[model samples]
Target: MPSELVFCHPDGGIYGLQFPMSNSISQLDISTMKELSNFVNLLSRHKNLSSIDLEFHRKGDVRAQRIINHAFSLNVQQLTIACLFKKNKKYSHDERVAFPLSLSGSKTLEHLSLRGSCGLFDEEIVLTSAQRFSSLTTLLLHSITLYDGFLSMCPNLKNLTLFSYRMTGSPVLRISHPQLSNLTLEKGECFTHTVNGGRFHVSAPELASLHFFGFCPQMFTTGDGFPCLENAHLSFHSRLECISGSYAPTIVNLLQQFRNVKHLTLSMEIIERLNSSEELISHRPCPLANLKSLTLLPEVATFVQHKHTRVIMSPEVQKYLLSSSPKATLTEVLTLI
Candidate 1:
């Protein structure tokens, strides 16, 4: 038997896999519940599997619970379970209940990613499963809510990624993880439909990398602080109001917050926003004395089409940055319009 098994399915349904008869299997990927059940039953003697990626064929399929139960009980180190939604309907209530219920018993799990259309929240699993995540070091949540104190329960968490989630009304979101080192937030489509809560206040004293893509938060402030941040990447998707004169200052303040960053990546739009006024640059120049490398990403669409094979930066913005951080290496990325 081989140590790894790969199952591929374009749409969905049971698919045949090139299975290895070994019990030392470390990774498994199955497209549908049918295939998953067959493999598990056939390999009944297998108990050393350490990672699994299971995707269900339907939104509310009852068989998904079985996969969750089996996967959770194995205490796999890395697990990703997603029950994709049907055209209009999201997940069934039972499907949603299955995951949290199974997750409550996790003992050896370290990295977990859950992707579903709806109904999964931190609050649902925190109470019973909080203690179970003592070994969890990383988490990725897609289309989930943060209203419940879900994050506070992970004591040893080091990396986190949030996608397609909403945060409303609260004046601030303060995340304080003692060992957290990497944080990425890619705001999904829901960001445009809701009013965002105020500034993001983070307190990861050991944090080293921060990345934000999509809509801009109202404000970005820190608590105990990100004293160890060495890399920062930022990109925005909406039109930033330039006439108000307030946008540039906000950006300057944000940049100043991470003055110690060594490597920085920014979208071309951010530089354009800053170039709107020369006075803004002169008065609030970011003191990036430690900056070693700088990369400017072009428009998202063009960057994707060109496969990021070229670099482009406007002379005006390039000159402004060169003056501020003369010792840092400059990298410009071009995007085809």
Candidate 2:
């Protein structure tokens, strides 16, 4: 019979793998479970092992915890969990799988990728029992729900990607890094509630690139500690019937935050829609003097502007930047409009 798990090496040794599910957990006979347990033990003892990938199919937290414990018991550097269960109208019954908090014991772990369920935000995963992942540097978490404390504990992480299934308040994040870089958010995760607990939430700094699902005029801010982000790729959906002028303050405040940003990319996707060059370019805002690159969907470039006025960089701002760092700052200036 073919094995459910197999590891091969052409050189024929240093190691190889074959394992059976724990106990009689497999769909097959009991003998294989014993064989599988032995293989898992061999894998745990293998010194060269640096990573493990797990599939949680039972939709039960108990089994998931056992498998994760096996991986953590090893000095694994990376772990990836593919969660096959999804939450639908059935609700509570489907959320029994292991939450993100249950897998925190891998002290040497450097990278982690998670999917399936609303695990990260599960209320049962208590933070007090969680151990600090001293060496973790990268994390990718996708869920139907996520909250502030998810990142509050992972202090050493450098690169991170977060995706949420539905819209929710922007969970505050406080990051500390000496040489960290990339950051990304997908879908509804980009929208944040600035007035959470009556205080504005901030994101990580030293981030080089930021990508979101839609354009958020509220994302830009004048807050004293906001990141002077360098590159941004923002997406947008067509505005249908919004309360006219209802978004003015949010829009203004958002753009003001990008005062120090340099490169901006805006994307607007339309289904079976045709737009003219003028209509597209008109909405694009005037480029800042410090901006080195600008990209826009045709409608935004045509419509996003200071009413009928031209979108041009101010001469004073350009001269000031050129005087400070001509080689790095003044060498490239692009006007998309």
Candidate 3:
């Protein structure tokens, strides 16, 4: 028998095994019940672990919950769980895995990532008292349905990344944190459609960097603005036809929130949209006031001929963008698709 055993399939037969010279295994990637059992057995011999990554392909809610409980018991610092679903496969409500409530109160955990289709704070699970992740600092949630008050669980978080997040029970998504410094919001695989003029309200006084990609919300409000911000990157893409007049004002207003940023970057698509809205641009002053360096990125293209093409900003758009920050150095970056 080998020192370490791993079973990739649901059957009891072992497919692979490993023999370590010493008890120094710190990280594990588990997918099946047999693998999980071997992990539990290995834990008795080696008590110290750094991280655990778990992936589930089908219905294994009970096993998944048990794995999470065991990870917490071992005081694992980093945990990542992803529940993958097959294409065109329909699963019932009960088949969906619920986020284990037991791990919410973990104090040793520092990083947590949850991806794919999983239920978070579903109605089936109820909490009697408040739960807090006292030591968690970094959190990444992708392709998951989020409920209000989710951030309240992690009080000391410093970095947050939300990709394709779908909101439940409220149209408005509010993010307010005191110690948070970096925030990235990207419209990933599950872009939430704008309904009833959906919006985002962010209030992070200590924020230093901000990156927003894909379709922007109808309205983005940051109370008192990001006074401590130094870097900002804004890129907008839409599936529908680009209507300059439709998104011009919203983009302009969004830029105003980052007026204090010293380094700024804009995509070519944004420049084009602003160019067609000359009338609108003429009326409003430039949002950026003090920029150290401004960079323009080329739009992505699939054609072979357009791979290394240089992107040039029209004089009208350049003047409008650089009017307030005349001392800022301008640079256009060449991008290859």
TM-score list, all predictions: 0.70, 0.59, 0.74
TM-score of 2: 0.59
Per-residue alpha-carbon lDDT of candidate 3 for residues 1-337, written as tens digits (9 for 90 to 100): 2243333434212122233344333344555667668766775555555665655554354664565566566666777766553322354554533333344467888988867653432212212223578888898887666666777788888899987666655667888888889999876323344422246888888999988775645667887789889999886553343333577777777777777889998877678677777776677677678788898877633222333344466777777788889999988887634
Backbone clash numbers for all candidates listed: 6, 20, 0
Cα lDDT of model 1 by residue, 1-337, tens digit: 4344544444432222223454443434455667667756854455666676766544344455665666667756877866553442354444433233234547688998876554432122211233347788999977654543556766778999877755433445567788999998876434334433235777788889999876556667777556799999987543433223456666666777676789999876567666665576665455676888998887544122333333344565566556567889987766536
Error of 1 at 189 (Å): 4.3
Of the two candidates 2 and 3, the one with more favorable TM-score, higher being better, is 3
Model 1, backbone clash pairs (residues 3+ apart or across chains), number:
6
Give the best candidate by TM-score.
Answer: 3
Better of 1 and 3 by TM-score: 3
Name model 2 segments beyond 4 Å from true: 1-36, 86-101, 117-130, 165-180, 189-200, 215-228, 238-244, 268-287, 298-337
Q: What is the C-alpha lDDT of each candidate?
A: 0.62, 0.46, 0.65
Ranking by lDDT: 3, 1, 2
- Candidate 1 local lDDT, residue 16: 24
Off-target runs (Cα >4 Å) in candidate 1 are 1-47, 60-62, 87-105, 117-132, 143-146, 167-174, 195-199, 240-245, 277-281, 301-324
lDDT of 1 at 90: 54
